[model samples]
Target: MNRIALAVCALALIVAACAGSREEVVEEFLPSLESTTTTAANGDLPSTTTTRPAEDQQIDELIAGLADQVREIRGLPLALPPLEFVPGDQLEERYQALNGLKSIGSTRINEAYLQALGVLPEGDSAADLVSFCSLPGFFDPESATLVLREGLADLTPYGRRLLFDELAGAATNEAHDWWGTMASLERSGNTEAAVGLWALVQGDAAFHAEQYVAESLDSTDQFAIRLEEIACQQESTSPP
Candidate 1:
């Protein structure tokens, strides 16, 4: 499916949360939309419009508002990159595709070295550890794009907070050249310094995100968002 279709599907799924059952949710969400397809000028992926034009515009506005809030809270000037939404199920595929472009041998060597140093567990590769430990959404510094997990359709409280987290991250990157610094540290094999820097960067973003929540959202929404975040964290770390 094309990107627009995937976005519509993602949004639809989010709306479907109030509805019952997975199969029913998909059926309810897809049947209401109209779709049209056209090939891109570059002859790459075909572009499709699967939802109302206003839906896309709303998403753009939502991002802009969140970005402004992030800048306000973090006190950083931000030039936000283009935004892309991928279906939640395609997250792993998208991650692997991006990860594949890196130097595999160097990455493996680093993973082995880190594991030997007890930075990573014996069986865990760097890629696997990152995929598991990091948040679902990320700002890709190389591509200068903010890629978010799709299900942000209705701008539910949780969805809004999650989007804010990514915006905060993007702002942090803009201010600090986060990825470039991390890459330099990695190349120099300064593992301890790299880890410390990574922690500080993430903590900065998290702090701003929390500030946004506390300052902007209503008390009810603030509580709900925090509860959902904690639940998600527990779910991610839980044993299958």
Candidate 2:
């Protein structure tokens, strides 16, 4: 399948909690939309309950509005920009658009555009991802996993590493970590994500067991061999 199709499936599966039926699920996922606050040391904007700044409050309201609409879409489709657009390119542009649309917080606009873009197959799914995004929980690993699996390219490498590092720190929680997520994805046989996760495991000592690491290394060797074969075939196809 194409990358867009793959991204759609990833988003569908990982967005479960955000789209679950129970009130508890809604409550659990709601925190992802809350505005974040960082101390002066982190060079972040400050926040307070009663004395929150106007901009922060505005962002909060906007997110709340967006979350309400996304809750209505049960399935969201996947769409890609032009193939000419390279990965990590247009990040600033995309961020600006997302931020602006979010700040506007018009549920109608969110529904119309997200559906038009095929980001939401059903009203319900669109709502879920909106909730996921609006909760502003992408900084958290459990939350970040949802966005990552959804194929969003919002965070920088450093930001992504920080989120995953946090998840790594929570190795004790079976709900978190590569192995746990791998097991979940295994049932679905997400080959690309599995491969990517294995690649991640190969580089990180804390993520996998010796047996898993060894197996991954063997797979890496096999992959290199296969890649060579493909490259050779392409070369043969080209003019002499």
lDDT of 1 by residue, 1-240 (tens): 111222232233233323334334334322321121211121112122233354456666666777777666666666666766677656655554443313443321244544544545787654443322224455666767766666544565666766677666666666556667656766886543443344444445655666787899999998887676566556555787
lDDT string for model 2 (1-240, tens) is 011222343343334323323224334322422221221111112122233334434433332322222222111111111111112323323332332233322211233434544665654433233211111122122322212222232432222222232222222222224445544544564433433332233223122222222332366554653454345445534575
Q: Whole-model lDDT, candidate 1?
A: 0.52
Model 2, 100: alpha-carbon shift in Å?
28
Clashes of each: 0, 17
Superposed model 2: Cα runs more than 4 Å off: 1-55, 75-240
Model 1 lDDT, residue 144, Cα: 72
What's the TM-score of every candidate structure?
A: 0.60, 0.20
lDDT (Cα atoms) of all candidates against the true structure: 0.52, 0.30
